[model samples]
Target chain A: MNDPEIKRRGLMLVLSSPSGAGKTTLSRLLLADDPNITMSVSATTRKPRPGEEEGVDYYFLSTEDFGLKVNRGEFLEHAKVFDNYYGTPRGPVEEALSDGRDVLFDIDWQGTQQLMESAEDDLVRVFILPPSGQELEMRLKKRAQDPPEVVASRMAKASDEISHYTDYDYIIVNEDVDMSLARLKSILTAERLKRKRQVGLSNFVRGLQQAL
Target chain B: MNDPEIKRRGLMLVLSSPSGAGKTTLSRLLLADDPNITMSVSATTRKPRPGEEEGVDYYFLSTEDFGLKVNRGEFLEHAKVFDNYYGTPRGPVEEALSDGRDVLFDIDWQGTQQLMESAEDDLVRVFILPPSGQELEMRLKKRAQDPPEVVASRMAKASDEISHYTDYDYIIVNEDVDMSLARLKSILTAERLKRKRQVGLSNFVRGLQQAL
Candidate 1:
């Protein structure tokens, strides 16, 4: 239903959630379903895992190179997690936005806050929550990659992360993945229809008025 | 899925468009499909048409009663169109909103401005436009109730109405009815998920935190 004549600036869709809250699954689903959106590739100082490709999985960089990019102010939002530094590169996302393509960010609250500071108008922040504490613990433990002590530590971190739910524009208590995905798609659809985002609307309306 | 534990305050969905922009058709379709939203019945001084029922089609009132309601500040918005007066009663709408039921208004730009003054936070205004000036004229002429002279006058009035498109929150160029209806539903769904509209979210989050 989009009018070809009316050009729109794309929005920054940031989905933040605690670990094991189904954010990754939802993000993957949305990317596969929507043609207009692309996942944001982050630059990280962490070593790449096996089968992880450069630029596709992440922009793997040494500490010096990452520091240089940070000094150059090339990242939209950056943070240090444990001993590794990770940040979203600013150039590609800006290019996508101007060309009317959305960039999706699967980041935490701190990264979302940084994006808000830089591009408040373009950002649509949605926080995802587990149905209950018990559910969250179960999901965390079900991932057998982590031991019990790791799961306990992750739960503590999840508590801190979920505390920032009020900072988001929309909160989804993700009881079911499909329902949450539908709501996320609805948010994207509605935000695209916003009057301010349609950059060429004034010219189109002006042309209509002149024709009348 | 809606969580019963987290209550939400309803939104005021105002749809404004020119006479032949398919707003009325879209409104009817939305009302028939969505059980959660109801039309905002206005109180008017005009005599009821055949089969028009009181408190359903309209709350037909005398000029004196309408004037009294206006003087008492009972109307959320009241306006005199030609010789007759029409208004939205604040009491019923407020009751519905507090009960988590949405009210849809098929009013013009003037009435929408008044609604914005009274309930800016609650209002989600959408303005529809025809695909072109020629299409708008064709649609107006297709309605056989109006004569050619009336159609010409409506075209003039439509030009005026179309100028207010920038004042709306969302703008839809109505190329097809089904597409427009889908966009309308997305807007409602997204607005319902807004953080400010979710009234009981804080307590729900607090409960989750305590459980954690």
Candidate 2:
């Protein structure tokens, strides 16, 4: 009794979190669990490591090419980090969206802000937080053998990131990884059912109306 | 390491559908499964049916009382059907929302429109549809021993109701009850975590910032 398959316009799901808030783990689980969504590949000028594959890990570009792409506005959002350039390519994300495949982005708040300006309607921003400041600091300490000053500096940066929670549409506190993952799945599922995203819904409904 | 429990502002979840479209079944399943949401009780001028309890089923009211409440703007929405008046009392729903308990409404499109006008920020509207027009007709016929004219009338009404799908935030086609219920639960869970509904998030974030 179901109608013909409805077409959907995909969304850009941005996950922004502090260094120790478990965003990467949740994103990995989501990609593994949901086949409809793919991780967004960024273009980077940084030299790829031995195991990293071009186009899969990143679109490895030369410095001059990266600057040219930026000037041509090919990147949806780009930034210079240390000496390397990194940006989300506008072409593939738009292509995936038009084909009804969601793109997941693991980006910082600044990158998310840039995407917001370029593609507000297509974006769903979620800000993840650690269970507590103390827990975040502990995770940072345990992750590396960095000295106290380095750990302190990371904590300050995390605090700065956490301050931008208000800028996001949804916020998840990473109390338990499993619970947070479940919440993330729910958010994605719900957002996909949003009226605006279902591109063929009007035609489907109109068909029913005519059938009656 | 989790922060203190944050307060929330509850939402009004309105589910609307035409007759025999599985709305009642889905609503019943949702209420039985979820503890945080409760069915909204309406005040009615109609006499109670057999075994229907006051306040639990409805707040039975006299016609005069209903009129007075309407005059005072106490009802969120009101309507007259046949010889009786029916309305959603604004007081209890408001009280529940302020206490972080979601109120579920099995309303028609008109009632949903009123809620949108009166409480836009608190409202989350979902429109449910039968999987197909033929299925809807079959369900309506199977439910009763009605004649052809009655069935035809119902089909027309369903068509009219389905036309308002654009007015809803989410749409779910009832292909299977279990799947539809799952989608409803996801919508509820996701809407609860929206940033605007989490009232104490600012303070919680501030505490994290200060600790760092």
Candidate 1 ranges with C-alpha deviation above 4 Å: A145-147, B145-149
TM-score of 2: 0.97
Candidate 2: clashing pairs of residues = none
| Candidate 1 clashes between residue pairs 3 or more apart in a chain or in different chains | none
RMSD of each: 1.7, 1.9
In candidate 2, how many Å is residue A123 off?
1.0
In model 1 chain B, where is the ten-residue run with the lowest total lDDT? Answer: B203-212
Cα misplacement distance, residue B112 of candidate 1 (Å): 0.9
Give candidate 2 regions above 4 Å deviation: A1-4, B1-4
- Candidate 1 true-interface contact recovery: 0.66
- Superposed by TM-score, candidate 1 places the C-alpha of residue A101 at a distance from the truth, in angstroms, of 0.3
Model 2 C-alpha lDDT per residue in residues A1-212, reported as the tens digit of each score: 12247788999999999899999999999999999899999999999999999989999999999999999999999999999999999999999999898999999989989999999999999989887778887899999999999999999999988888888998888899988989999999899989899898988888777778
B29 Cα displacement, candidate 1 (Å): 0.3
RMSD of 1: 1.7
- The candidate that wins on lDDT is 1
Candidate 1 chain A weakest lDDT stretch, 10 residues: A203-212
